[model samples]
Target: MFDWLQHIADWLVYDVFNLSTEQHLANALNFFIYDTVKILILLFVIIFFMGIVNSYFPVDKVKNYLSRHKLYGLEYLMASLFGVVTPFCSCSSVPLFIGFVRGGIPLGVTFAFLITSPLVNEVAIGLFIGLFGLKTTLIYIVSGILLGTISGVILQHLKLERYLTPWVKDVLAQAQREQHLFEAEQLAFKQRLPIIWAEVKKILKGVIPYVVLGIAVGGLMHGYIPEGFFEKYMSKDNLFAVPVATILSVPMYSNASGILPVVQVLVSKGIPLGTAIAFMMGVVGLSLPEAMLLKKVMSLKLIAVFFGIVTLCIIISGYVFNVIL
Candidate 1:
């Protein structure tokens, strides 16, 4: 199906520019061209459909279900699953987090949703399948959901409600008293087009720079990195490799789609599959931008705890995959 697209890229690079694909510079340019076109096309189609689905599912209903449930295990599970479909970026996820907290949802359950939303975005899943195949894609999805669910359940058990920011506690208390409810507004079918278009534009604007940067870095790594660089340092036999990858991923700002190309190159160059996957998850699931955004509503201590727990889980997952795979 994609043969024609590859032909077009090849034609432009080889025929038009007279550049040989065997050259490192030409290879990098071809990588950039193919990935940019493919990702942008996927982004537009998937995000547009996601917008339509999101519009149909009113936030009030979502909040009500999540908040009213006291069944901790079930709620966490549901929140993690719900996150798979929501596909929110880090900044947008914050408002939903606030609403969840305000609606009296447990912090842990809300955190579950927050963790999975970006990690389990449809675009990421689709790209993973395309780039890494089905088994790896399933591993990513299942592990991502499990991470969110387990982290949320642990936080709930620890009774960490007191660790929230003072303002968040105040808001929650006020919400409990006032019991403000969200009323669902039904929009006409035609009205939905503009909403979807706006969302598509907003999403594209936010992600384009990261996508470009990620592809550029990936292109360079694909073309120019020494073949044995990762094999020497990040092989499965290196006990510290998983931990290092997990730690490095936390501060990275790129989304899963942005970083997958580089990860592909890393794995092709002989980085352990588990280590590469761990790094990809870290970048997508936890980031400096996400922490800064969450800071508005969470105490610094709580943020630290959240980051620590997630990092630990990712490291464990990496090691397990390394041993098993």
Candidate 2:
């Protein structure tokens, strides 16, 4: 499927630019061209398709359903799965997190959505399939869902709702949802196209920079980093690799799509798949910026607890993946 892209890369690098395949610059440029174009194409198609799905199943519905139902712990899984369709990064998921809080959904269920929304989404899924193939992508999706669900359940048991700001408490007391927003949406498919297309464009605009930047960095690593450079620290044999990778990722922030190319490069550079994936998860799901955003609604202790729990889960997942893959 991507052979044509390879041909273009070869032609541009070898035939047009007249650079040898052996040259580092040629390799980097080729990787950059192929990955950037491929990822963007996949991202566009997936986002547009998911936008249609999202139009039919709005966030309001998810909120209402979860709020109204008693799913015997299945609700956390449902919320995490919903995150897959949302295509939000950790930062972008904040407003929806606020919405879930205001909707009176249990804080744990909300945490499930917030945790997975950024870590695994349609955008990242499309990119993952292109970058990592099906087997790895399947593992990633399942791991992401499990991470969110487990984290949500753990946090729920802690009863962190008490740590919510007084503002959220007041809002809960006077809760009023704008259900009217979707009340008149019986439009034809064609009628919804423009709105969906606009959203597709907006999302693409918001995400393109990160994708390109990540691929650029990946391209450099693919071309210039010595094989086994990353293995020195993150190899499977390294006992501290997974936790170190997870901890190191907290300060960095990027969406899954944006960080995936780098993750691919890490795998290629001899880093264990689990460690590399954990690092990606950490960066996407647990950034400090996300903490600052949560501070408006959550106390410092709650934020710390949330981050701590997710971090531990991610680290454990890293080890599991290492053993499995």
Candidate 3:
């Protein structure tokens, strides 16, 4: 399957178009533009619909009901599902985390939402589905949710609640007052278009730079990175490769959409699927930016612990996949 896809991609780039270096660069730029546009469109559409749902649905009531339940498994499932639907980035997630904590949700459960929301977002999922097959995409999504839930539960059990910043606790106290407020006059769907567009513009402004950077890195890897490099260091036969890849990817941040092409190159060149997937997961979910953002609400100890746990989980996942497939 991978070989077939690679053949097609190769044909598209080299045979049909006969692209030169300049043309390859142009193609790279075109890919960046295409990816950015697609992500922006998906973000706007999903968030706009989320806004409409927020306006009409009784979220508070639902949250209140869910908060009464103490089943950690169920809570994790719900939190993961919530993540799939919420249109939030890592930075934006702090506010929602604050709200969840203030609303009396367990810290572990909140973490589940925080981790999965940005890492396994709809736009990322859509891109993965398009680039990889359905099986790999589904596995990625399920793994993200499961990781979030298990991590959350483990944190809760560790009693790390004391590691939260004092300010975070204080902020949680105001959750009751931070209710959503909509205009008294309800706007029709047609009227909502402009409002949604403005919100979309705001989101695009924040994401465009990161998207560009991700694409630039991807383009370089696609066109110039040596196939032998991956084979030597990241091959399935290399026992240390999984952990090494996981560690190396932690400081970087890029979603599957941006990384899939790079993963394709790696897999084509003999990198292990598990190692590559683990690297991608680490990059997407346990990034430097996420750690910095989390610092605002957590102590150094908490952040270190969170990172350690997720990194361990990713390594295990990689090894597991390696053994199974």
Candidate 4:
């Protein structure tokens, strides 16, 4: 499917620049150009498609639906799946997380969405397809959903509502007093195009930097890094590799768009796929920036507990992937 992109990269590297295939710089530049264009195209298409979905079923509607419906235990699953389609990064998802809470969604359910949104979404799905192919992407999506659902359910059972800050308590009380507001008047499909297009552009604008930086970092690694360099630390033989990678990644932050290409490079360098993926999940899902944003709504203890559950889930997932893949 991406054969044409490879052709373009080869032409630019060899024909236009007149660099030989043996040159590392040529290989790096080729990797960058091919991946950049391919990922951008994939991201643009998926974001625009999701934008239309979001417009039809706006945030207000989703909030109301989840708040009203019991959905049995599946509410957690629903929230996690919703997180997959939404394009918000870790920090960005927190505001919506607050919205869900204020709208009376279960705190654990919101946690499911919050945990998954950053780790897997439209942008992440697209990049995963590009970097790891369909099979791995499907596994990743399922694992993300499961991780969020499991974390949310466990947190819900903990009865941690009191752990919320006083400000959030007030917000929740105010929301209870307010009446439900229905959607605005519907517009023609043609009228909605502009709004959706604007959203598509907005999403692309926000994530493009991450994509480019990630791919650039990946290209350098691809071209110049010695094979098996990372394997020494993260290879499958190392039982603790997954946990170490997951823990090390917590301090770093990047959305899926930025971190996925680097993940691709890690896999190429012989790091166990599970370990690399676990590191990527930690960076995106358990980022320090996300914790800072959560501080506004949740107490420090609540945030710590949330991070703890997610960290454990990610580590488990990493090990599972290493064994299977």
Give the number of the best model, judged by lDDT: 2
- For all candidates in order, the CA lDDT equals 0.71, 0.78, 0.65, 0.76
Residue-by-residue lDDT tens digits, candidate 3, 1-325: 1244445545666566677645656455444444444444554555455445544543465466766765648887789779877755543454466446544567888888877776687778887777767888888788888888888888878889899987656543322222233334555666656654564455446445644565455445444444234335677677899988888776454555566677777777778788888887776677665565566568999989988888898898888777765
Q: Least accurate stretch of 10 residues (summed lDDT) in model 2?
A: 174-183
In candidate 4, what are the lDDT values of residues 164-248, reduced to their tens digit? 9886676544333222211254666677677657645654674566567656765675577653344456776788999888887
Candidate 3 worst ten-residue window by lDDT: 172-181
Candidate 3 Cα errors over 4 Å, as ranges: 1-68, 87-89, 174-232
Clashing pairs in 4: none
Put down candidate 1 lDDT per residue, 146-264, tens digits, no spaces.
Answer: 99899888887777888887766654443332222111345576766775676467556755665566566655655665433433556666779998887866655455676788788
Error of 4 at 284 (Å): 0.7
Look at candidate 1 and tell me the lDDT of residue 110.
Answer: 86
Question: What global local distance difference test value does model 4 have?
Answer: 0.76
Q: Give the TM-score of candidate 2.
A: 0.64
Per-candidate TM-scores read 0.63, 0.64, 0.63, 0.64
Expressed as tens digits, the lDDT of each residue in 1-325 for candidate 2 is: 5689989988998999999989989988997787678766766776666556555666456667866777888989999999999886675676567656655568998999999999988878899999878998999999999999999999999999999988667544432221232337567778778766775576567556656665676567557754434345677678999998888776665678878988888888788889999989988998765676576678999999999999999999999998898
Quote the RMSD, in angstroms, for model 1: 8.2
Runs of candidate 1 with Cα error greater than 4 angstroms are 1-72, 176-237
lDDT measured at residue 193 in model 2 versus the true structure, 0 to 100:
81
